[model samples]
Each structure stands twice: as C-alpha cells, then as structure tokens.
Target: MSLEVEEARIVIRAGPRRIFGIPTYLNMLGSVKMAPARYLAGVARAEGRPLYAEDPRLRRALEAICSECAAAEAGEGRAVSRAEVVEAYYNALAPQLLSLAPSIDSIVVPCYTGALGEAVARRAEESAPGVALIAVKLGEGGCSWADAVYTAQAVDERLKSLNLGPASLAAISAALKAAEELNLYSTLVVLTDGR
Candidate 1:
C-alpha cells in the first residue's frame, strides 16, 4: 500500500507539573531519520507532518481524549496517574488514526505509559496492513520501572506480528548512535497531533 505523504514533526509535551517526562522513545525514533526520508518519504514523513484535521468532530474527539489525563487540576478531586492520562490519550487518538487509514509502513512507539505504548503499536498494525512496528524505551523516562518492564514484555510479544523495516534493539541513545554509524530507517512520521 502507498503510505501517506507529508512532512511533519511530533513531540510529546508534558505539563510543568506532572509525571516525570521520559524521553525513552526518542533514541529509537532519532535512529532512523534519513533512510525512510528517501525510501518511504510519504509514509514516514506523514507521521511527522502536521495534521489538517478537517473534521471538526474528529478534532474535538481527539482533543477531549488526549486531555483526559491522570493529571487534573489541584482540586479536581481525582487521583490520576501518568499511566491513566497517557492511556486516555492513546484511546482517544486510536479512532482518528483508524479513520485516517494512512497506509502505515512503520509504527513508531515514541511516547506513552507502557500500557498505551503497546496498545498504540498493536492498534497501528491492526489499522494498517503490512505495517512495521518498533518501540523506543529510555532507561529513565516517564513510566515507572514496573511500567517499562511490563510494556517491554508485552511489546516483545507483539513485534513478531509486525513486518519491520529496520531492526535494532538498544537504548534510545545507543540505538540512535548505531543508526548514525550505519544507515537505516531514516524518517519521523508523526502519526498524530500535528495541529
């Protein structure tokens, strides 16, 4: 399938007062910034491109879903965890990705609590046939050690199903270093949140 075509950048922004923001997924994403740019520019770049969000309803849906976080106002009277907030964001965005149906050639697991990270990977594949999915986890990031361990385990189990374009299992920084040394998956596709 021909992948979506565009140029973009995606960043996961954590508010000033919230969970410890982890850049765990950065090493992996930064690793392959060139190869995909040339070969699968459309698909890869599509992830990085800004979203047009023509549908008002979908835009509203996305905003609502992502904003529903474990982090509430000081007096919102709720105990929300980082995981809970990320999970809600993932759930909210899933439908948009589903409806957009960009011919996904690669899936980037950039940022999410462990549960949401795995969920995003699995959901991406389900939504796009013949999709390649890879994840990046920083040694010290937002999610807890327990969250990382469990998310890693779950992701390992699911990766077999995805058709990968590049294969490198290492820390984000190291993986990125190796990619710079060697040549591989060089593109950043921001699947969502480009507005």
Candidate 2:
C-alpha cells in the first residue's frame, strides 16, 4: 500500500528513546538495561562515524522526514545555548539518540531549550510528509514527564525488569499519562539532559 501523505505531520518531537534510532534499538543499544553512562561513554568513543554523524541510512531517514517539511516550519520556543552542549554531549556520549528515526507521524521535543530540539524538529518537519512537531520539558529532581517510567517501557521492555514503578505506583501512573499527553505513541523520540 502506498504511504499516507496526510496522516503524518511535522513535529518538534521529544520522547524517550535510545540516542540512536531503530538500528540501535534493534541492537539493544537503546536498552535502558545498560549501566548508567555505559551507552553515554560508548557514543563518546565514536563521535565522527556515519551512524552518528551522517551515514547513508541516516541521510535517507532525514531525507524521508524532510520530505514532509510543509506543515510547521520550526519550533517556536525559547532557545538554550546549552542545547549544543547537550547535543554534543549526548552525541558524544550516546550518538545513537541522534540516529535518524523511522518516518514518524509527528515530533514532540522540548520547547524550553529550543536548542538542538528546534534544529532537529525543523529537520523532522522537513523529513516527514506534513508531520506535526511536539515539544516537552523535564525539570531537575523530577519535573520532567519525558523521563517517566511509561516512557522507559516503550524502548525497554526491561523497565518491568526493575522494581521501580511498584513503590511509586501513583507516580508511574502519572508518568504514563504524561507520556500520552506528550504524544509519545509508538517509538517516541526524545532528547534529555542528565547533567
């Protein structure tokens, strides 16, 4: 069947997925199961590679997202100078997050920094066909709904592997709601700062 040209919309999407896109997911790199900083350090090690920088596959994916660049032109939020730092940091630590994703219906990134998110969102707008962009934010200690457990489960079936949500059932439930509100449907793509 031919792809629907309308259902999709450009989105400044920000969900919780591996640094890399599907290929990383397939390789289990996106897996939350890894030790903290494990993936981060790994990405740092391979900074200037095709997969991290601009591989053919990534170009193809970005091209696909760019194909739908008519809807939202760009993210209309405050910009953060640290975004490049975050992007550079994340890319260096977990370049996988930068991995081009599958053609998405829309994108939901944080409008606060508007740093890398805006650039990427614009790219997403151009990447998909009439895609919708979304933005979100997460505060320190725990104001961010993006880092919620519900978001975790999407990428890591192993979320259930840990006994975290049980104690905070209410919190976990709320996280799920937050995830939904953020338009974190299937394969949500997000960029966050752990620093």
Candidate 3:
C-alpha cells in the first residue's frame, strides 16, 4: 500500500491564547506515525511470518486472530523496543513537521509511553534548536492510560467542531491547559491523530 500522510494546520484561539495544530489522521492510512509499524506487521502477517515486538501495547494491538498468524512476542528471538519504534516514527515525522512549521516556538504533544516525548525532544534539539516540547504525561501521575484515553474521548465529544481524533484532542487539550498555566506563544500542537 502506498503511504501518504496529509495534514491540515489550524489555529485554535481561546481568549488571548492561540495554538497552531496539525492533524495527521487525515492521511490515507487513518493512523499517523503508527502507520508504518502497523503496515509492516500486516505485511509480515500476510506472509505467515512470526511477529515480534518488544512494545507490549503494539504486541497486543497487532496480535493476529487467525491460526495462520503468529502472536507478537518480546522474546530472545527479537528485540524491538518502544524507543526504537518511537525513533522510527520521529524520523518520518520530523521532516514533515520541520517543513510545515520551521519556526514554531513550542510544540505540545501527548506523551503515551514517554518514548515519543524523548524522540521529539531529541530531534528538536538536533535539528530545530530552541523549540520547546511540552509533553502531557498521559499514563503517569496516578492516572491510568485508560483514564487518559477516556478523557481524550470526552474532549473529542465536546470539541466535535474541531473534527479531530482522540489523540489530537489530547494534544490540543494539553496545549490549551498549558496555555492557561504558562505563557505560551507561537505554539504548535502536534495533532498526532486525526479523524
């Protein structure tokens, strides 16, 4: 399958606060940076190959239902850490982000496993220095990942006019909330997922 990622940059303004957003779910794959990993897993499954993923989330998500497919594992046979997955995602994501907004002051993103946050911060330092990354920890601080997911879903339901996915809502919510607490300007909210 041909992978094509498309994004729409929008300005979200509340009172004197404003944040730019790029929605990535509009891509042909329906998922943002997760597309490549999922695609590769699909290809392996189609070829009747055993899948291996060190990331528990990915392993569970990509587990095949049929007997022809093998389950993903974090075994001695292979080691694909979550960091590696995030790095690959960031490698593909950075160019698009840099090309779209090379001079943004800050980026607000949702931190799921912390790997994505680290990848974004590292890449921003290497390429786009001076760019601040604000990661809202989703599965930490006594809050379960499920709680964050449900909260994002609620935010999506309320902000239906924005036409964004739950992940996008999470980022946007974090950016807006951060705006209220901190002085943020020329901020870009990485809408990691879109509808």
Off by over 4 Å in 3: 1-7, 35-51, 54-77, 140-158
For residues 143-173, what per-residue lDDT tens digits would candidate 1 score against the true structure? 3312122122222323233222222222222
Give lDDT for model 3.
0.58
TM-score of 1: 0.33
Q: Estimate each model's TM-score.
A: 0.33, 0.31, 0.66
TM-score of 3: 0.66
- Point to the candidate with the largest lDDT: 3
lDDT of each candidate versus the true structure: 0.32, 0.31, 0.58
RMSD of each candidate relative to the true structure: 16.7, 15.5, 7.6
Badly placed stretches (over 4 Å) of model 1 are 1-76, 81-83, 98-102, 139-188, 191-195
Model 2 local distance difference test score: 0.31
Worst 10 residues of 3 by lDDT: 142-151
Best by TM-score: 3
Model 2, 1-195: lDDT tens digits are 011112221122234411111112122233221322232223333442212212222223322333221112223211212443344434432333324346334333433333434455434444443444433432122223222222222323333332323212222233344445655443333433211
- Model 1 weakest 10-residue run by lDDT: 16-25
Question: Which parts of model 2 are misplaced by more than 4 Å?
Answer: 1-100, 110-112, 139-185, 191-195
